[model samples]
Target: TGVASGIAQWENNAFPGDRLDQLDVTNGQVFVQKVDGPVQFFAQLGAYSLPDLGSPYIRSGKATGNFYGAFPQWFVKYAPNDSMSVLAGNLPTLIGAEYTFSFENVNVERGLLWNQENAVNRGVQVNYTTGPLALSFSWNDGFFSNRYSWLWGSATYTINPSNIVAFIGGGSVNTETVSSAVTPLYQNNEQIYNVIYTHTSGPWTLVPYIQYTSVPSDPQLGTAQRASTFGAALLATYALDGGYSVAGRVEYISSTGDANAGAPSLIYGPGSNAWSLTITPTYQKGVFFARGELSYVKATSTTPGFAFGPTGTNTSQTRLLVETGILF
Candidate 1:
């Protein structure tokens, strides 16, 4: 069990105050497992509060959170052995996923490309092992609901073990908006691909990876629609001399154009490109540990434009995020 919190102040971003500042409470969780078995059980719950939590209106809507659920996940796993398994409920998203709760991640925040493209979903997933390869797929409720139908699946393969380790595969995300909450309905989907290379020794490891999102525009928006968007990033981590470790990631994000930019009420951004940086520092000791992270999400402007303002639409908002937590 564990609990922790932090106070983050910012300039020119989202939050409730005379200025951009927020006092937020990060979430917490708990777990219990047997001494030995192919199975274990866990559950998590958290309370997140910040000024100006986005609302169901405005670009991603505008408001404040007495509590913002941080993708809190609960699931059950059955491992017949080490080669195959199945899971249910809110599950672990793969690849870039969300900006938090990544067990092996050292970055305080995730890439904007990841936030705009990859995400954790809830539903059912299967795990399988074949020699040196691992495979997975997911079907869950997506980031949008009611007006849209959602399904997602991803896979990973590990090969070339030695000084150079590698993982390769891809995922496909699908959604359809048939109901009109704001305007003419449409469909959206993407094919995502990523790969990573790593070398490790003792308590240290270094990894670098590349990712891409191929978005196909909606026919409803006509041919002026933007083509697929691709992004690249580099991330590295090192264990230090002070019983601590640090990580940093830089990514350049680009979006062609919204096929659904013409939606009923929601609005997307103006520019086709944006940049994000994530930094994380962590400390650990025996049965207890703590982590701190700072992330900067920026685009070309902050005019408070109301694109993709919910109504069940997808929109990316620029933000400054800081989080600290402890576990025992």
Candidate 2:
């Protein structure tokens, strides 16, 4: 499988390293997977970009080069029976409802809650299913730090045919100091939890989720004080006639601690909070598709030098984006 996509974006309150308008390739990637018998493998290769609300955008070229390289994911799975499987290598994280790539999500950009979750990790995982319950557990490097000191797990329960619920939690067992374009030091050592519910009916799909993350006070880890964030998001999509669909997302996140306590800035600033709304209308025909999105974000109690704009004083931002692509 392969996908190619391009994006044109216009936004206000540009962050320090961001521009007001830009055009770039969003996704040009190939996926290979083999699923049969007792052995299987999956791999994703090439370049891709991750766009999200309330974050500065990175171009596809730099995103691929600086983050996960040309091969973002590659894993081998061994299924010994119908209910048991073991997987190892670079695998996608099970901590969030949204995926890492642009083409795998419902909206053009990810929500605020997605910012606090890990996207991928190198590790070993065990999966098992019995009746209506599916479970998975993994031991991996948190935040791609390559130190392999994190434990993660997820469980999903099917309730009837139209609804499902899932619980996910993960955290680092030891402190990690590695920081890079793909890893944030504080977040790598933090604990995270999520509760998600999904509902589907005739032509509509709805998802609601809540997230919590806590970074403990550890001087050795460079965190002077304990800090945490609580966030909630709702994502919904509706299908219309003639290959048309509409999707929207709403999110709110609030951080704990303040400047007086020297807490790490998890969001806009210590004790700062933010909210965002996004709407995307899409049209698809066969392997071709197009989508336009409008999103707005606002911050409160933001620090003077850590918010938005050229000088980092703006508290609000609005963005317009259009994406066109083909999946083959």
Candidate 3:
């Protein structure tokens, strides 16, 4: 797989080295997997960018080197029976509805709610399927911190051919002070939960999900007060004729805490809230694909010097993105 993209934005949150207009490699990757036998393995090697809403953009080269390295995901699975399997690896996380990479998502840039979730981790996972229900549990490093002190689980049920629901949750078993490009210290120690529903009928697919995350007060962790976030999002896609499709997403998220009490900044800042809307139109044929995205974000109750623009005082931002890629 490969991707190249360009971005144009207003109210750019000029985070020192970031820019208002940029060109970058979105994905340069390959996958290798074997899934037919009792011993199965999957490996993904490449460089990729993690473009996200309300955050500074990191180039693909730096993202690959600073976050998960060149080989982001590789796993070995043992399946002695048809209903159960055990996997050990640098695994994809089960905490959120969105995936880690651009090609795996409906929109080019992730939503505001995704900013509060973990993407990938190093861990062990077990999966089982029975009837219409599927279950997965894992012991992993939360926030890719490599501390190996997090427990995560998910339960999914299929109600019919067109309806499915899932409940997912995860948290750190111990406070981890690790901080890096992939791991934010406060988020690494927080507990997160999600409730998601998916419905598909003919040419339309819809997904709705709600998320909650809480970071407790721990002086040892440099947090003097507890802070939490409540978020909701809806993502939908409509397939049109002649290899065309359109996707849209809307999200709202708010944090709870008093800035005066030394609460950690979660979103724009403590006690801040944000909402976003995104639209993507896509065209794909055979091994090639292209997409264009338009998105807008607005923040309220934000602290000074913590929002958007070069001065970090702007409350709104708009962006346009174009990406062309191939999956071969």
Per-candidate local distance difference test: 0.48, 0.93, 0.90
Candidate number of the best TM-score: 2
Question: RMSD, each candidate, Å?
Answer: 6.5, 0.8, 1.5
Residue 50 of candidate 3: its Cα lDDT?
91
Query: In candidate 3, what are the lDDT values of residues 1-328, reduced to their tens digit?
Result: 4444443343355655678888888888888899898999999988889989889889888999999999899999999999999999999989888999988898989999999999889999999999999999999998889799999899999999899999999899898888998999999999999999999999999999999999999987888899999999999999999999999999999999888898999998899999999999999998788889998999999998889887778898888888888878
Per-residue lDDT of 106 in model 1: 64
**lDDT accuracy of residue 203 in candidate 2:** 95
lDDT tens per residue, model 1, 76-150? 777778788778766555555234344334653445555444343466777887876667766654432322234
Least accurate 10 contiguous residues by lDDT in model 2: 216-225
lDDT per residue, candidate 2, 1-328, as tens digits?
9999999999999999898999999999999999998999999999999998889999999999988889999999999899999999998999978988888998889888888888989999999999999999999997888999999899999997899999999899998888998898888999999999999999999999999999999888766789999999999999999999999999999999877877898998889999999999999999999999999999999999889899989999999999999999
Q: State the lDDT at 78 in candidate 1.
A: 74
The order by descending TM-score is 2, 3, 1
Model 1 RMSD to the real structure?
A: 6.5
lDDT of candidate 2 at residue 298, scale 0 to 100: 95
| lDDT measured at residue 160 in model 1 versus the true structure, 0 to 100 | 54
Estimated TM-score for each candidate: 0.69, 0.99, 0.97
* Pairs in steric clash, model 2: none
